[model samples]
Target: MGLGCKMISLEPPILCRLPPTTPTSFRTKTIVFSSYAPDKGGGAVSTGLPKAHTYTASFKTLGACKLGISWYPDFEYNAQGGTGAGTGSKVADDANELSVDFDIETLYIPPLTSSTTKFLGLPLPTFLKIDIVPQLFQGNINQESGKVDLEFLAKFCFSVGSVYKAPALLVKTVLTSDESKGKIRGGRGERLDEEGNCKLVGVAFVEPIHDFFMDSFLT
Candidate 1:
């Protein structure tokens, strides 16, 4: 480990193949929104804000396997009067800085098939993510008003499933890299592209559960 760098690890990865003709279990969605404002922030003495921020994170079980996707979307908020000087008291001060952060993660506990064995071999997971939205609030408010209310939305699509098991003895020939979009389909293949870029294969999520969190974060 370097003086400021943290270590990250993972495991073998399996590929999700699109059906030859039509892909099953596909979902599509879209979101629409609007906002009307007339000086969102009241006087400098008011505690309530005409502007607000919100967050969300979630995962839906596809078919009862032990894996799911993880995602975090940027939030929405009412812009405070800070860009250009306005008529009022300028509204914000050094201590008036307000930044909000939100995160959501969905984990899994390996499930088994109906066979006498203790694991399942049919359940496979994958991921798909695309968020091309950047900070669009800068142009929303007029420089004359100095007050702004901003609205933004984000979306993602990904899947999570296990690859292989260690059989309680073998050191498990682990393979990990970051070629999801083109991360081939096989049991063990960890190679570099023509230019060289490491892929992210599998990962072990054993830091701790609800009970073990205190030792890692609350200590």
Candidate 2:
């Protein structure tokens, strides 16, 4: 009987980069498996996969300035997914497209003060103060392109200490990272950056309210 020798060929493993996976539940999972490739020294090296991320925006332009009437001092708003809001999801059929919705209502704006709030770059009168109550802040952010467009609705209540308080001014606008044009007023916004900082600008039309105080003030 003659003994026969046979040779076997083994193929190298394939390496690929995968997109980040959306978290299905509160639990975090390892969404990506590391892909390894041989280096010049024949040692395996990993080309890391993308991971899901969240962003908190620090607004640089939160107020308006027009005809010497201005509202100054920027504010910070953190955008996160919660009970009524939707988390990031792929918007288009393309796997790389992702968009996140923000419906924030719990956070309150810091009390307005002369030191913080200014008019025409001059400090507001110490006796005068305003309270901002956010009713709804819903928006969509394109993750890849850094574009942001939001519908903001809030009430600005003016007060003069314990003496008097006026009816809330219902302020509503479509804030965006692009130019916001209106018949009387317009603004421009900046796109979200890597550090989650951007300037959101909007043009709001002030509708006449039935309240005597508000009407008188506007007129």
Candidate 3:
């Protein structure tokens, strides 16, 4: 008999039900500017140079979200939040400043794709992992509005069967927002107890994949 042929269909990613007690938390960090002044033509090298000032602030309990007993399908990611102190740097010409680091834990893609309608008897490689990690985020912080504007480029790589793709640039301008309040499982505002500690929902958004290399790998 000649080589046999078979057909296999691939489905899209479906929303799975998460446990009611799925644990998640959110935290807000604040950078406050206490004061500022412009150089009154007083800099040794240049006039109208910026002058330094003093500022102090802390992140209080903005809000939190907790899920009770319910049977709802949701996509949940486990994220931990806690309070700690770290030394930060600021230019001599600036007031208060804050620094933070961001990490991309995973890149999730919906299961189905146009090219993956059906598989013939021929075999194919199994995809193991695809990751895009950025080194640093560059942006400005608006203390008054409690917002941070940042961007970063993503480095991409993936493993398929025994072969691993070399890392390359895949994405950029991964902008994020934290100015809005967060919602819990039930879409309720975060609740605060007598103590300042509050448990809030953590949120992260993934923008469109830009590079064709990334798109091919995902599909």
Candidate 4:
């Protein structure tokens, strides 16, 4: 009899980063619905309300601002599920991309841009506006179905002449290209119907990001 030997090869498993998540609800420690006339004697009222724009706002301040996020299909990868259960199919790490947008009310900005500090500091603007537009984010998609839950977290402040000022925090999230078809539900149980008109919009596949706000009154 002759002796024979055989060799076997094994493939290694691939690892990926977990998908990003956005909160569906939020709670506020302090909130107030306030109104003031920018020109008290002139009858010019400024309630910080948003005027038919791609932004969501609180009417308690000087103006309205918006935030948005978007996601796109990774047509290049198009990989099917092999990783695990409910993992579905997956787009390549490089194929998936994310975008963020911020539409800040210009009126809230100080006439002199130099008057404000670079970071959060004293003498803060009566109101601050921050805007972000749809832009690519650096990361990967772990799902095979290309489904994503997008979130835009914001903490904003409102100030009135240094006497009345407070912080407003919020978290906005939306499901992208899913069964819902990109419809967003607001904190107050409001639904954003018009795609372009909604303050936060999601497309392709989306995820979450954070924002900040502060307040101080100036005479």
Candidate 5:
């Protein structure tokens, strides 16, 4: 028996419909980004505020008086209000001035002992000892200029082995990159340099204590 075969056309319909075209204005849009992109020159683009940085330093000071006493202070800058971990903000009016905080507990000063301290090329007596404990350290620094001005507050404890112990002498001063003048002492400081070295100077007045020993010693 012979079978009949049917032919089918694959051409599209003559009335085929096309989707409507979008308006010229609607086809393009302007997008705004909170951050800017780098320029064609390939320069860096600032996204927002600058970030906080931590710094460590060892500060040393030598007296110009007769005793020739010296101090070695080691400290670390937290840059986070001294509360441990976090980023710090900048001053409201100055973007270059960054608020800094320091870890007071980390502040250390070598005791005036025979091994660590000397006086006029002579080793200090073992019986006499002096220690410094930082109470407060907070200030602002110009990141771009490397200028620093920090308010430093510390206590100087004096003791003579088992013989006597003096009350802590409160010392407060503004350690700065500029000059600091007190009633009896004054000095100048230097700004931070490319090697991260800077000199901070401050003069603090030693007030008389009510105790007889302190008054006599200070006088």
Candidate 6:
């Protein structure tokens, strides 16, 4: 195994380390609709309302390069916004050479539920996103190398109207991509380098996607 054929777990990646700020239209944006809380123009919502929380979660992989874990698989989630998106970055010399030996799983419980405890084993509502940063030739973020090119983007989407007060409607989804890696250094800096090649693993929404507020919103 070498830089050209290393396995790295891929997981949720975020954009603009900030929380959603778009205001929902009271008439249209909001599902159930909420009125002003008396004189309190900014009446707070539920106390359990998550203040846009984020954390790092991790799993194990047998090898970084050369040799890989037999049963564990080479793809190990380094870190993420709770879903193993934090462990760090992975860079490989050969882009198409990296391979793994396992399936993917959700590393965190999204603020939204993946599903409800139903008789049909139905999944709850939830959201998922993944960010990928790759250092092409230069493979360095600190150095100005032309050998590697860094490219990154995040595929994000959330179940619309998942807000506690909102009347969940259609299974709405919004996605966008951005650049996470730029200025290729000698190799991925703080980012790690495994054996053979690396592909930052792959993204998975382990949690099932469901529609809880289908009656009022979907109608």
Best by TM-score: 5
Q: Work out the TM-score per prediction.
A: 0.18, 0.57, 0.33, 0.22, 0.60, 0.20
The TM-score between candidate 1 and the true structure equals 0.18
lDDT per residue as tens, model 6, 73-145: 1222222122212211223453222111111232222232333111123333344222222211111221112
lDDT of each: 0.18, 0.39, 0.28, 0.20, 0.41, 0.21
Q: How close is candidate 2 to the true structure, as a TM-score?
A: 0.57
Clashes of 4: 11
Determine the backbone clash count of candidate 2: 0
- Which is the winner by TM-score between candidate 3 and candidate 4? 3
Clashing pairs in 5: none
The parts of candidate 2 lying over 4 Å away from their true place are: 1-87, 92-105
lDDT of 4 by residue, 1-219 (tens): 000000000001100111222112111110111223234366555567532212111201111211122121111111111011011122224323222222332112111111321222233253543221212111111123222223323233334554544443232333222222223211221122221111112222122223222211110
Candidate 4 residue spans exceeding 4 A from truth: 1-149, 175-199, 202-219
Tens digit of per-residue lDDT, candidate 3, span 1-219: 000000000001111112222112222222222334445675654548444443332222121212121233332221112122212235344443334333233212212122221123221234544342444434433333333333444443444546545444343332223321222232211222222222233222223345465444322
- Specify the highest-lDDT model's number: 5
Per-residue accuracy of model 2 over 1-219 as CA lDDT, tens digit each:
000000010000000000110000010000111122324565654568643344332222122211111132222111111112323454555454444433454333334556544555676688877665656655565656655555656676778878888777666665555666544334454555555444455555455566686565544
Better of 2 and 5 by TM-score: 5
Q: Candidate 5: which stretches are off by over 4 Å?
A: 1-87
Question: Which regions of candidate 3 are displaced past 4 Å?
Answer: 1-127, 178-219
Model 6 CA deviation exceeding 4 Å by range = 1-12, 16-149, 161-190, 194-219
Please state every model's RMSD to the true fold in angstroms. Answer: 19.3, 20.4, 16.3, 25.1, 31.6, 22.8
Residue-wise C-alpha lDDT for candidate 5, range 20-122, written one tens digit per residue:
1100000000011112332547676566854333333222222211111112111111111111111234577786766666566654333445654455566
The TM-score that candidate 3 achieves is 0.33
Q: How well does candidate 5 score on lDDT at residue 23? A: 6
